[model samples]
Target: MADLVSELRQRASALGFDAFGIAAAEARPDLSEKLQAALAAGWHGDMDWMAETADRRASPVALWPEARSVIMIGVNYGPDSDPMAALARRSSGNISVYARNRDYHDIIKGRLKELAGLLSRRTGEAVKVFVDTAPVMEKPLAQAAGLGWQGKHTVLVSRQFGSWLFLGAIFTSAQLPASEPMAESCGSCRRCLDVCPTDAFPAPFQLDARRCLAYLNIEHKGPIPAEFRKAMGNRIYGCDDCLAVCPWNKFASETREAKLFAREDLREPPLSVLLALDDAGFRALFSGSPIKRIGHGRFLRNVLIAAGNSGDRALLEAVEARLEDEDALVRGAAVWAFAQLADGERVRRSAEAHAAGERDAEVRAEWAAVLPEVV
Candidate 1:
C-alpha cells in the first residue's frame, strides 16, 4: 500500500499537479458539524445547494459508497503580479486572478481524469474524478490528505502554494495508505481578516458568504445591496483582497500551467469597455473563460456597480446608455451609477425622465432610492 501511494504521488507530480495526497474514504464528523452550523446560521446566503447536499458533501463514503481511498490534488494558479494593484485602478474592473484566465474546472478536471485513468490502469481499481462541480468537500479532504491547512479565511493555504490552489479529487476502490494531515500553522496572523473590503469573516475560520464580495459578484443573481456597493469598489467579477493579503503567499510560486496564466485583457479590464459589451460581444470576449457562465446581464450588473464606485465622470455616458436596457437588473444598476457620477440636479432630471416611463417596479425603486441620496 505504501509503495502504491509513493508511485501515485510521483505520477500525479508528473501529470503537473503541484501537490498530491491520499485520504481514507470515511465520514468526516468535524466537516459535518461545521457545515450544519454554517447552514443553520444562514451564512451560505443564496447558495441553497450547500444546504441541499449537506450529507453528500460531508463524507466521501456517502458520495461514493464503494470508494475505499480518495486522492486529493492541487494545481497552483498563483498570479505572477499583485492582484490587489488593480483595485487602485478605479476606472478598471478588477477581475479576480483565478477567473482572469481559462476556467479551472476545465483545466483541472481533464488533468484529474488523465491521472485517474493512469492509476486505474496500474492498480486495476475503478475510479471517479471530480473538480469544483460536485459537492465533495475537497478542502477538508485536501487538508486530511496533507495538501494544506485551512487558513483563517477558510481557504486552503499551502506552504508551497499559499491560497492560490485549485483543488480536484479522485475516488477509487483501492485501499491506499493515507498521508498525515497538515497542521494549521497560521499562528497570530490577522492580515486576511483585516484586508476584507466587506467584513465577510464573522470569526477566525468562519465566513459569512452573504457579505463576501466574491459571493455578491459571482453567485448573487439580483441587484447588489446598496450597503456593499461602495466597499466593492472596482471589483466586478470576484474579490481577492482576503487571499492576496495572506503572508503565506510569499512562498507561492507562479502556476506552471500555460492555460492558467492571467490574460492581459482580463487583468484590469476598463469599466468603459466592459459596460459597452452587448450579449453577443460579451460571449465572444469571455469565450471559454469562467466569466461567461454569469451571462451578459449579470456581468453588466456587476460592471455598473463598479462604474458607480469608480467616481470617474467619464463613465457617466456609459452608465446612461444602460438606463433603458431591457434587463431590469441592468437598468437599476445604471440608475445607481448615474447618482454616483452626476450632480444632484442632473440625477434628479434623469430619474424624473426615466421613472415615468419605467414599468419595472425594481428599476423604479432604484430611481426613487437614489433621488433622495443625491438631493
Candidate 2:
C-alpha cells in the first residue's frame, strides 16, 4: 500500500500536477473552534454562505466520515505575460490572469476526477473528487496533505510552484499513506503584506475578504465602496496586486496549459470597449471565462469605477450613458463614477436629469448627491 502511494505521486506529477500529497481524512482538532471564533468576529463580511453551513465546513469528519484519506493536488497556472504591466495602461481594463481563459474550476476539477478514477481502478476503492466546490477547507486540507503551507496572505505557497498554483482534492476510503506537513517558510518576509494596495490582509494568514479586490470585483454583488475606488486603479475585473508582488513568484514559469495563458484580446482590453458591453454582449464576450459569472451589471459597474479613475474625459460619455441602465446597481455605480469624473457643468445636467426621471430611490439619492458641492 505504501509503495502504491509512491506510484500515485509519481503518476500525478507526470500528469502535470506540480505537487501532490495525502492526508488522513478527519477534521483538525482546533479547526472548528478557530472557525467559530473567526465567524463570531464577523470576518466573513457579506458572505452569508460561509455562515449558513458552518458545521460541515469546519470539519472534514462532519462532511463525509466514510473518507479515510484525502489526495491533494496543485496545478501551476502561472501567466506568460507580466501581471503588473497593465496597471500603467489606464485605458485597458485589467482582467486577472486566472480568469483570462477557461474557468479553473472546470480545468482542475476534471483533472482531479481523472486522478481519482485512476486510484479507484488500481486500489479497487470508491473515490469522490472535489475542487473548491465542497465544504472542505482546501487550503488547510492541502497544508495537512504536505502540498504547501498557508502563507501570510491566506494562500497556499509552495517552495516549487510558489503562490501561482490552483488546488484540488480527492477523497477515498482507501488508506493511503499521508505525507508529513510542510513547515511555514515565510518567516520575516512581509512582501505580500507590504504589496497590497488596499491592505486587504488584516493579519498574517488572515484575509478581510471585504477589502480584497478579488471580492469587491468578483464576489461582491452591489456598489463598490467609495474609499477603495481610486486605490483600485485600472483593475476592472479582479486585482492581482498582492499575488504579483510576492518575491517567491520569481520562480514561477509560464503556464504549460494553453487555457491558463492570457488571451491577447483580454490582456489589456480598452476600457471604452468594455464599458460598451450590454448584458447579452457581455455574455458573448466572456462566454468561457470566469468573468462571465459576475454578470453584466456588476462587471460594468467595475468598468465605470475604472473609467472614473482613468482621468480621461474620453470615457465620460460611456459612463453617462449607463445612468439610464435598467439595473439600479449599474445606474448607481454610474452615478458614483460620473461624480468622480464630475466637472462643473456635467454634474449639474446629470443631477437635473436623474432627479427628475430616476424612479429607484437608491439611485435617485445617489443622483441628488452628485451635486458639485456634495461631490
Candidate 3:
C-alpha cells in the first residue's frame, strides 16, 4: 500500500500537479456541521447550489459510498506581477489572476482524467474525478489530504504555493494511505480580512458571500447593489485583495504551467476598450477565457460600475451609450454610471429622455432612485 501511494505521488508530479496528498474518504467527519453553519448564516448568498448539494458535499464517502480513499492535487497559478498594482490604473479593467487565461476547469479537468486513468490501471479500483463542477468540497478535502491548510480567508494556502493553487480531486475504492493534515499557519495575520473592499469576511475563517465583490461580479445575476458599486472600483470580473496580500506568498513563485499564466491583454485591458465591445466583440475577445461565461449583459454591467468609479469623464460617452441596452440589468447599471460621471443637469435630462420608455421595473427604479439626489 505504501509503495502504491509512492507510485501515485510520482505520477501526479510528472503530470504537472504541484502538490499531492491522500485522505481517507471519511477523514473529516466535522464537515457537515461547518457547511450547515455557513448555510444557516445565509453566508452563501445567491449561490443556492451550495445548499442543494449539502448532503453529498459533506464528505467523499457520502458523495459515493464505494469510495474508500481520496486523492487531492493542486496546480500553482502564481501571477507574474502583483495583482494589486492594477487597482491604481483606474481606467483599465482588472481581472482576477486565475481568469486571465483559458478557463482553468478545462485545463485541470483533462489532467485529472489522465491521472485517474493511471490509478485505475494500477489497482483496478473504480475512480471518479472532480475539478470543482460537483458537490464535493475540494478545499477542506485538500486540507485533509495535506496539500495545504485552508487559510483564514477561506482559501487554501501552501508553504510552497501560497494562495495561488487550482485544486482537483480523485476518489477511488482503493484504501490508499492518508497524508497528515497541514496545521493552520495564519497566526495573527489579518491582512486578508482588512484588505477586502466590501468586508466580505464576517470573522476569521468565515466568509459572507453576500458582501464579496467576486460573488457579486461573477455569480449574482442582477443589478449590483448601489453600496458595492464604488467599492468594486475597476475590477470587472473578480476581486483578489485577500489572496494577494497573504504573507505566505513571499515563498510563492510564478506558475510553471504556461497555460495558467496571465494574458497581457486580459491583465489590464483598458476600460474604454471593454466598453466598446458589442456582444459579438465580447465573445470573440474572451473566446476561450472564463470571463465569457458571464455573457455580455453582465459583462457590460460590471464595466459600467468600474467606469462610474473611474472618475474619468472620458468614459461618460460610453456610459451613456449603454442607456439603450436591451437588458434591464445593463440599462440600470448605465443609469448609475451616468449619474456618477455626468453633471446633475445631464443626469436629469437623460433620465427624462429614457425614464418614460423604460418598461423594466428595475430599470425604472434605477432612474427613480437617482432623480431625487440630483434635485
Candidate 4:
C-alpha cells in the first residue's frame, strides 16, 4: 500500500499536480456538523445546491458506499503579477486571478481521470474521479489527506503553494495508507480578514458568502445588492484581497502551467470595453474561460456596478448606451452607473428620457431611486 501511494504521487507530479496525498475515506467525521452549521446560518447565500447536496458532501462513503480511500491532488495556479495592485486602475476591470485564464475544471478533470485509471489498473479497484463540480468537500478532504491545512480564510493553504491550489480527487475501493494531516500554521496573521473589501469573514475560518464580492460578482445572478456596490470598486469578476494578502504566498512560486497564466486582454480589462460588450462580444471575448458561464446580462450587471464605483466620467457614454439594453438586469444596473458619472442635469435628462418608457419595474425603480438622490 505504501509503495502504491508513492507510485501514485510520482504519477500525479508528472501530470502537473503540485501536491498529492492519500487518506482513508472515513478520516474526517466532523465534516457533517460543520456543513450543517454553515447552512443553518444561511452563510451560503443563494447557492442552494450546497444545501441540496449536504448529505452526499459530508461523507465520501455516503456518496459512494464502497469507497475506502481518497487521493487528493492539487495544481498550483500562482500568479506572476500582483493581483491587488490592479485595483488602482479603476477605469479597468480587476478580474480575480483564477478566472483570468482557462477554467480549472476543464484542466484538472482529465488529469484526475488519468491518475484514477492508473490506480484502477494497478489494484483492480473501482475508481471515481472529481474536480470542483462534485459534492465532495475537497478542502477538508485535502487537509485530511495532508495536502495542506485549511487556513483562517477557509481556503486550503499549502507550505508549497499557499492559497493558489486547484484541487481534484479520486475515490477508490482500495484502502491506501493515509498521510498525516498538517496542522494550521497561521499564527497571529489577520491580513486575509482585514483586507476583505466586503468584511465577508464573520469570524476566523468562517465566511458569509452573501457579503463576499467573489460570490456577488460570480455566483450571484440577479442585480447586486445596493450595500456592496461601492465596495465592489473596479473588480468586475471576482475579488482576491483575502487570498492575495496571505503571508503564506511568499513561499509560492509562479505556476508552471502556462495555460493557467492570465491572458493579456483579461489582466485588467478597461471598464469602457467591458461596458460595451454585447452578448456576441462577451461570448467571443470569454470563449473558453470560466467568465463565460455567467452569461452577458449578469456579466454586464457586474461591469456596471464596477463602473458606478469607478467615478470615471469618461465611461458615461458607454453607461448611457445600456440604458435601453434588452436585459432588464443590465438596464437597471446601467441606470445606477449613470447616476454615479453624470451631474444632476444630465441625470435628470436621462431619467426623463428613459424612466417613463422603461417597461421593467426594476429598471423604473432604479431611475426613481437615483433621481431624488442625484437629480
What's the residue-level lDDT of 91 in candidate 3?
A: 97
Candidate 1 colliding pairs: none
Candidate 3 scores a C-alpha RMSD against the true structure in Å of: 1.4
TM-score of each model, in listed order: 0.97, 0.95, 0.97, 0.97
Predicted candidate 3 versus true structure: per-residue lDDT over 1-375, tens digit per residue:
788788888888888889999989999999999999999999999899999999999988889999998999999888988999999999999999999999999988998999999889989999999998899989988999998999989999999889999999999998898999999999999999999999999999999999999999999999999889989999999999999999998887555562277888998999999999999999999999989999999999999999999999999999999999888999999999999999998999998899988899999899999895432
Candidate 2 residues 315-368, lDDT tens each?
A: 888999988888998898898888777696878877876767777887877766
lDDT of 4 by residue, 1-375 (tens): 778878988999889889999888999999999999999999999999999999999999999999999999998888988899999989999998999888889988998999999999999999999998879999999999998989889999999888988999999999898989888889989899999988999999999999999999899988898889999998889898988999998888655562267899999999999888788999999998999999999999999988988989999999999998989999999999999989989989998888888888888888888985432
Candidate 3: 10-residue stretch with minimal lDDT: 252-261
Off by over 4 Å in 1: 254-259, 372-375
Residue 245 C-alpha lDDT in model 3: 98
lDDT of 1 by residue, 71-181 (tens): 999988888888899898999999999998889898888888988998898899999999988889988889989999999999999998889889999999988888899
How much lDDT does each candidate structure score?
0.89, 0.82, 0.92, 0.90
Task: Answer with 1 or 3, whichever has the higher lDDT.
Answer: 3
- Give the Cα-based TM-score of candidate 4 against the true structure: 0.97
